[model samples]
Target: MPRVSGVVGHVVTFGRVLRQAGLEIGPNRIADGLSGLDQVDLTRQDDVYWTLRANFVTRREELEIFDRAFQAWFLRTPVSPFELSPPTPQSAVLRRIHAAGRPDSAAGTDESPAARGWSYEEILRTKDFGAMTSDEFDRVRALIADIAAERPRRRSRRLRRHHRGRELDLRRTIRESLGAGGDPVHRQYRLRARVPRKLVVLCDVSGSMEAYVRPLLLFVHAVRGSGKGVEAFAFGTRLTRLTRALETSDPDRALQDAARSVADWCGGTRIGASLKTYNDDWGRRALTRGAVVVIASDGWEREESGARLLEDQMARLARQAYTVVWVNPLKGHPAYEPLAAGMRAALPHVDRFLPGHNLASLERLGEVLMGIERRHAA
Candidate 1:
């Protein structure tokens, strides 16, 4: 917009672009920024970066984008390059030499500079694990797996291996030892302290629930792969049994297999029908005696009949399993309530209704599982 007209036109054009990009900068802020630029000492590249950053950057992520755009658009051939360390005398020498290499009398420069390194925490903090770019999301998922791996395992009954460690069962020992000479031999008895046995996950991959899907899936995969008592499932349009899919050691292969089984990825949620299907077909089969059922959804079922159906299924599941926890993402919100039709209908039957949004929420879930495991162990 400015090239044909002149320097007078460029300032007007820049203001319009910044406003369109969600910045609150108006003619006043632009004037403030323009005036502020003159007072700010920006001899160093980073000093120029900070000068613009202080005037323009209101949010963290914007700093990175604004930095890049500012540098490329304004300071095409900056007098100095950005220094990671301080603007030292040595850096000044290098800057002067670099500047000397370029045309000393360069014109049409805005004197603005780019921001520093990419805004890792800023862009990433808002990113949902499932929707991130492959490499970026993989990093998050790997972190989730690492965190889950580091979590302390729950004390389950299967872990009680020391049968003989209690008061030595003299009566039983003598009875069994009769085959040999009555020698008080050290007979070791071990408990089945294996990983969690049954894991029934009802992930809500609906429109609203997409943000948490990545980390959530990573968490599910971590438990399922641990060779504990785990059977994973994903529910959207219907109930998907992912037990076999998760058995594969490779995360990518496991997820691919799971994706193959899940005909409905992100669609309308039918929690009631899904739970009913699980109850009718696989409930007794999967639960066996008792299993841990974690339902990861926002409790936004579109139908009350479905909610009721889910309630019935949850009731059945509650009886067959060690515990029934409803992991609702909305629960993480400050002003959240269990007022949704799905939540209202199902909350009555859930053993626990917990949040599943951030690292802290996952840690809380781990704690809850520990307590549930202890109760079942006894």
Candidate 2:
């Protein structure tokens, strides 16, 4: 990548590198690169940025990724005229090719396009968790893990807020940074209290939830893996503690153990009765100190019809949890409406109503969880 050769070839090489890096680039993207450089004037950085923004990026999420990749590839190269010869080595073209014969890994794992809410984000934001398979569900789990593992958006956020924007809480700032010397030479930063919160996941494993149960459990696992405690329960005719089952280090083993323990897996729904049991027994144990309680269910409510009890118990649980989110798989469908008796009853007790039918929708729970974190930290 010397700065003394063919310009077009270098741009082509960079584009190809990105394609190898996991972008869905094709002959068309390659062509766009050639024309893009001509119109944008590679001589100017902003011009080149806009050119790629228009020709290379099609989705909102890709912008962040494509930008970073562009910067790393182009800016890192010497400013002198680059050796623009075509990539000669076949091995170079083959670098980082995923099984799909294309680059699939994010350009920067840190600035993941996924975290920027890419195609998968739309899927989660738009679809249902119940309809999604275990693999798709894992992707959602990964997104949550990504967000949770990330320190903070701005470097300043990790440092003292005063540096970012907050007026120095002069007393604490000076006390923490100042030494015995008259002049302050070293400045120690205070860690800001973020929106720290806990999460509680209550999933329905009745016959009605078979399609969605595994995925939702995986979602819970992702949250828990990110160093957060999550209490999970799968209920049918009766309620069972999935907390211990999910505690195993391995996810697959945890799911299998949980499935084996829940007798009602794919059994009939006993909506009100289950909630009653939860309110009477598990709620306080799991919902301790105000956690975000997320209920994943289809809301069929076929067992003995005690909608009033369902509402009451959910209300009690809601009072203890910082926030209540009701995720209904049916909501994932395009035509789906909240017409189920159980859904209507639980709706009142919920802080947010969402679809949890597929990996796409369930991943959104991360954003919801992040919001709760912000609130708590504030």
Candidate 3:
């Protein structure tokens, strides 16, 4: 293979090419494609094409676009460095592809602005979910899944044999010692195994939180996909369980299924009544017991007596849950405060209050979940 220092640039630009053709190619996919290329004979066109295709194309419908892009980018001859004609979008894209495919030694003296540390992916991490366009959101969904995969762990009651365990497995040790003339030269030990902790998400899907609901639900769906100990519920005027609906592998289809499952997709806000219902039905059934409870809402309450009821429900929930996480998108704003009646009421019971306005905030939420400790709140 040629000294392709620009392989990173090539993969990144090629991802943009696929995205331009309406395919959902995220940064992670680009990174995967680059890694796949590393394991293959780059000089072999078929190997290169299939490697890129396997990482970039997610659906049968995207095959045609992927093939066209691969052909145009990898097979086409380099364009002239200087062009006489006025630049257009297609021409601009071709030029970028050509630039990305160029060898490092053939490159110009000036370094690209991206080499200086600022990249579009960095900007996207901090960009608010509410402001993202459809294409941007599509690209970001994969990153969201990666972040959600970091689930909190709890020590299981059942013990597993471990070399570093503190408790000696005397029975096993004695059984093995019989074969060694009753000398206990080797010893076995047991330790409680760490397993994923139960995660319960209660997302607000009311009209007030319309801009953030989709991303929040996507986060919930990703968390649900991580392992078995996850439950998701959506609430606006009422509570609706969405764990099964979001189980579909396809994010788009999963979102659609979740929408259909929730009767109040984007209707009135009744934070208190919804919490009360959850407590009565699911919480009493021990769904919330020792679980990491996450509530993604703007804290808007429509009912007149919603604040008081919300406060009481939050208290009950905190008592049952191992940890309570309150995620408010508005909190991302500089001047924002917990001024909403529902927010104000729920704060006392929340173990960790976080902003869920962007990918960075969500990443922080994941980190918090992974290292979260039980709170002794009253």
Residue 228's C-alpha lDDT in candidate 1?
A: 65
lDDT of 2 by residue, 1-378 (tens): 233247767767877766655567777876786676666555788887787667777777566667667777778843333222223322211121111122333233464545666665666544454444434444555554454342112122343444454444556546755565544444433455453356667788776676667667767766676664567787877888788788887666677667666666677788788877876776655654467677888888884456777877777877776677888888877898888877888888788888876544655666666655332231
* Candidate 3 structure quality by residue, lDDT tens digits, 205-277: 8877777877787788787777898999999999988898788987667776677667676788899999999
Question: Which residue pairs does candidate 3 place in steric collision?
Answer: none
In candidate 2 the C-alpha lDDT for residue 89 amounts to 29
Put down candidate 1 lDDT per residue, 1-378, tens digits, no spaces.
Answer: 112334324445655555555556667766656555566564466765666567767877466556655665567634333332222223322232233224332334443122322456345444544345544443345456654542224445543436645445556667668777877574645454544445567687666676676467668887665566666778888877787777877666666556555666666788888888878877756663466778899888887477778778777777786667889877877899998888888887777888887655776676676556443341
lDDT of each: 0.63, 0.64, 0.82
Q: Can you give the TM-score per candidate against the true fold?
A: 0.57, 0.54, 0.68
Quick one: ranking by lDDT, best first? 3, 2, 1
Candidate 2, residue 170: the lDDT equals 59
Better of 1 and 2 by TM-score: 1
TM-score of structure candidate 2: 0.54
Per TM-score, the best of the predicted structures is 3
Q: At residue 68, give the lDDT of candidate 1.
A: 52
Worst-scoring 10-residue span by lDDT in model 3: 84-93
